[model samples]
Target: MAIPRQQLLVVSEELDEAELAALKFLSLEHIPMRKLETVREAVDFFHVLQEKGMIEAENLSFLKELLYRICRIDLLEAQLGSSREEMESELQLPGRAKVSAYRYLLFQLSEDITEDKLKSFKVFLGKELPKCKLNSKTTMLDVFIEMEKKGILGEDNLSVLKNLCREINVSLLRRIEEYELNLSGREEVLIPEEQKGSTGGPKAQARGQALSVASDSPGHWDESSWLEVYKMTSQPRGVCVILNNHSFAKARAAVPKPKDLKDRPGTHVDAVALRRVFQKLHFTVAEHRDLMADEIRKIVDIYRCKDHKARDCFVCCILSHGKKGIVYGVDGEEVPIQELTTAFTEQNCPSLAGKPKVFFVQACQGNACHKGVTVETDSGQQDSSIETDTRLQLDYIPAEADFLLGMATLQDFISYRSPRRGTWYIQALCQHLEYSCPRGEDILTILTAVNQEVSRKSCNKVEKQMPEPGFTLTKKLIFPVS
Candidate 1:
């Protein structure tokens, strides 16, 4: 049987001559799975099938093929370089970024889980869970339950999610289905997925059951498949606080001012460059020069009091001298890095709950340097509510989930700065972010690439520096330039 005339007309208009010919032959031959032309076309074709209730057991294989093809197309496009404006407009689509507000609820399920495990779970969500998007409102089991009850999940959505759960531990999914969370605003407006995963007729259900695959391992999914799994919008615009401490004096300053005449705080090369970069990514860059420890906390605290409900995420960068676990203020007083980070937790800063809080620290974690060996193996905070709040001191919570810390250097090594080029870590970071962020890379993946690039560099008389990232994020944090 031919595709409905109306659907065929739309498909023909969208597909080029070659794609149209291929579709016609496939329709005649009754082949279910084959490589398609464009991601845009594949998605459209799938929609037409779902609408017509023609998604059968045969179509499942086609579904897998289409998803993988979409990934390849996306990766190919990312590797291609168009004009800056053209690239941003084309890549950073709205609703593409994932920021789960119910992250606190997810945290409740496993207070004991490690960061590495959290990262793996995030990968599963982004890659395995089809038609599943997370945001600030997902705090309880009811969201999923309610969707199922209301007949919002289609056969295709169920098949994919079931496969996802089977591939992973699925304990997380169970906890989500069983555990209830104590959170404010449990009920919020939700969108209707009428086009795809909405309630289907009995005919569609029969088609889905026939096509169900029993295999547990993720099929046709590999590293390259991630290209379709993650879509970042550079539009998570909000406050980007820069605490650049450049000057210092007697009493052996804690974070010494930049000694490099060209790269020092006064030159503001890193600061300026960072501003341009974040602005390009849609953040409102707020630069604070030479802040004392208390001053830095106070500024971030003030931001905490303001409403971040309108913003998609928060970013704070500290550039200064440092040792072991803290960075020094211009006055030489050290502020515990943990203190700056815990202030934005969901319990502490309700306004930012479920949104990303990103911190990039540019300081030496310790007084040592790194030396790279050949044939290398690679491996890969904010503020406030200080003072009267007394919350952090009592609870001692680390930065909440959805927070990312991209340190300038691995802990305990002095980060290098040139008299002109700027600090090695931030410069490399800024460079990669400029190139990668607009292309829709997740923050950690982007940081990993930055680490790889910086590790190859030699600064401070050929001493090596490495950038490290510490994250409690439960979902992929994509920075698609707005």
Candidate 2:
């Protein structure tokens, strides 16, 4: 049994003497203070953190203001192992940037963040803050506090918040100083009547800039103002091409089915489920069954020629037998994944340039099968593209970014198929997509949940399987909320 526990790690944007003293008083782990210039920089930082542990940090929703400052999805995805869609989903949180900005406003408005002003802020929150499918939670401060409970936030997040505020506006520096000096000695929300106006502090007032965005109720905080930028929402979205290769010619004895696979009935189930899922996403689902490896290339070439200028993304699924780094066709020949992806690379196919191109492969990557190990319970965890060939080098990055490959099982492992249901990976993926997408989840996030779900199932007593998604998506790829 996995023991549920609270772990501590101090995160700070800056830890001056006073903040350092607070750390001593709090008795929490004091992590090194670091600053991020890019999401990749953060990724580097997290990698350093992973040396200490797995670096499985919770979603840093509070720092979205900082992300907005950077607004680089590659960095976010690189650091968090998330897709652009995943981070954007988090960025839209109600108080992502607003709460911190509201604090700055409070410092400036010492006496002006009146109940009336606060109401105006609420109106702003409803309008500017991207509505998370969350339970109407608002503000970075609230999210930060929740993280602190999980021991996810510490001085590091605070330091980052302070730094983010300063980057957003210089006036924040003065407001922060005032906030730290609040005689209350306790962290209290700035009140209008209780605090005297900034009439006594002219220099602070002189440096202060007016906050144009609305904020949380009074001391409450909410969305981005300066750094919150929205990713382009595709006009017609995109289409899904599911190439499910279930049956091979009996004469092609070299491509024999697993003894119990039961004539590929589950694959049909997968095709049906996936079609419905993508159709609900308002995507045109094109299903091609029993294609040869070369034929697969032709289909991608055709898609590349189609006018996808209006589409936001693309999807392709391969359901068949496979080998390491390769999937098999109905003809029993191998198709290197690198070949499948390169067909639509920006260099080869400009139509999908910079757009998310996701490939879902429900084939075994290796002959290894999971011998059911003891299942571990996660107390509260949660959780594309292509190019074409000329024998694309798997060691090299895709010419274009924003591509993803979701593998059914780990490298060299066999993926399980249920005759009554379908492949474990596809079923879990479809189920999780339905459960999470409407909740503002991006593709990567839904896949993570799918990974968690599939990883836990018992294939045959002790046999187990796990699905993992790999991507270089530069932006978030979210299906339209249904």
Which candidate gets the maximum lDDT versus the true structure?
A: 2
Question: How much RMSD separates candidate 1 from the native structure?
Answer: 22.6
lDDT for model 2:
0.50
TM-score of each: 0.46, 0.47
Candidate 2 regions exceeding 4 Å error are: 1-232, 250-263, 369-399
TM-score of 1: 0.46
Local distance difference test, each candidate: 0.49, 0.50
**Candidate 2 per-residue C-alpha lDDT over 33-96 given as tens digits, one digit per residue, 9 for 90 to 100:** 2322122333344344344442334534433333333333443454434565665676566544
Q: Name the runs in model 1 displaced over 4 angstroms.
A: 1-236, 250-267, 369-399, 460-462
Best by TM-score: 2
Worst 10 residues of 1 by lDDT: 375-384
